[model samples]
Target: MIEAPAARAWPKSEAESLPGKLIIVEGIDGSGKSTQLDLLHKWLVSQGYLVVFTEWNSSPIVRSTTKRGKNRRLLTPMSFSLIHAADFASRVHTQILPALKAGAVVLADRYVYTAFARDAARGVSRSWLRDLYSFAVTPDIAFHFDVPLDEAIRRITLSRAEIKYYEAGMDMMLSEDIMESFQIFQGRILDEYHRLTDEFGLVPIDATQTLVKQQQQMREIVQPHLADIERVEGGDLAEVLRHSGLRGRYLQQPVWAEASE
Candidate 1:
C-alpha cells in the first residue's frame, strides 16, 4: 500500500485511530479524475466495501461564498487560495475524517495538491500554500492523472458549453482570447504538477490512454491494499464490522467557526 508522503506531519491521534484507507486522484481540470474515481467507488461498493466519496470544492460552508466571489470576479490569487483551503479544511473534518474513522474507504477526486499547482500558477508562493495545508491528513495513495495541455483543453471545451472566466485564468490577463489564456495558464499548472510528482510521491497515470485501460490499471493498484476488507460479505453492517474486525471508532469532528467574509 502507498503510504502518506514521509515529509508531511501526520497527527499522532489521527495516525493511531486510522483503520481506514484514503485514496486520492489528483490532476488538472479535464483529467478524468472524477470519472475514474466514480467507477472505482462503484467497483469497491460492488465488492462490499463501504466507500465514501469526496470532491474538491464541495464544502457547503464555503460553496456560496466561493461561487459569489467567482461570479463577481473579485477573488485575488491569495483569496482564492485561502477560500479553497477553508473548503478543504471543512471537508477533512466533516467528511473525510469521519468516514475514515468509521473504517470506510475514502475516495477523494482531488486533494491539496490542486491548491499547490493552481495557486502557484496564479503566482502564490508554493511554500506558503503548503504550510496553509499542514493540518491535512495525507492519503494512503495519491494518483496524478497526466494529460497533455492540448488534449485536456480539447476534452473540456468539447464536453462543456464554454470554459468559465477563472477556469481559463482570464483574471490574470494573460491573453485577450480566453482559449489562449487557458492554454498558457493550464500549461503552467501542468508543469507544476510534474514537479510535484517527485516531491510528493504522486503516482502518475497516463491520462491519454483509453478509459478501459486506465480503469483497469487503477483497479490493479487499488485491489491489493483492500484485500483484508474485500472478504466481507455484502451489505451487512454487522458482518462488515466482524469481517474487517473494526471497532468502529468515532472521530471527534472539529467545530469550525464561520469563515469571515
Candidate 2:
C-alpha cells in the first residue's frame, strides 16, 4: 500500500492581482483531457484571446537528458520524478510565468498535480513532491478528467501498438508483461488522481461523455473567467508569442489570423 502524507494546507491561492488566468487539466493518460485542452485552445484562439499552451515535461533544458535516461532505461522511480520536477521548474520560469505576467491565458496540459499523482504512484513521498513544486503559482482553474481504469486501458491499447517502458511503470517491476504492468501502474495513478481531486478542489469532468458534450461543459465553465479579458490584437499577438517561447511554432502566420479573416 502507498503511504499517505499528513494533510497540509493547499498551495497558495491563485494570485488574483495577475491580469491573466492560468487554466490547467489533469488526468491519467488516455483520459481525453489532452483532446479537450486542444479544443479549448483552438476556441480561445479563434475568439482572439491570447492563449499560451504548455505541456508537461517539454522543457528543452532537460529534454535530451530525459530522453537518454528513458532510452537507456536507467531512471529509478525517484530520479524519474526529479527529472520531471526540473523540467516543470524550467518551463515555469521560462514559459508559464512569463505568459501569465503578460496577460495571456495560459493553458497547461498537466500541472504539478501530475507529479503529485504519478510520483506518489511510483512510491515517492507526497510531502516532498509538494515542497519541490512549492514555487508554482496556483492555477485559477484545474480540471480533472475522470475515466474508469478499464476504459482508459481500452483507449490506450487502441491508439498505440504498445505502451512505452516508463509509461507502463515497468521500472517499478509490478509485472513482467508490459500490458499487465500498464494496467496496474495506471491503476495506481488513477487512485492518486482521485485523492488529488478532492484535496485540491479540482473540477471533475466526466470523460466518458461525447466529445461535443465534454467541450460544451468545459466552455461553459471557462466562459465566465474570460468575460472581462480583452482579445489579443495582431501586434500584441507577436509579443505574447515571443514571451511564450511559441514564436517559432507560429512562424507561418497563425491559423487564428486566417480564421478571423
The prediction achieving the highest lDDT against the true structure is: 2
Off by over 4 Å in 2: 1-14, 233-236, 240-253, 257-261
Residue-by-residue lDDT tens digits, candidate 2, 118-158: 99999999989988888888887888899999999999989
Q: Which candidate number would show the highest TM-score if scored against the true structure?
A: 2
The C-alpha stretches of model 1 lying farther than 4 A from their native spots are: 1-16, 230-232, 236-261
All candidates: TM-score: 0.85, 0.89
Quality of model 1 by C-alpha lDDT: 0.79
Q: TM-score for model 2?
A: 0.89
Residue pairs with colliding backbones in model 2 are none
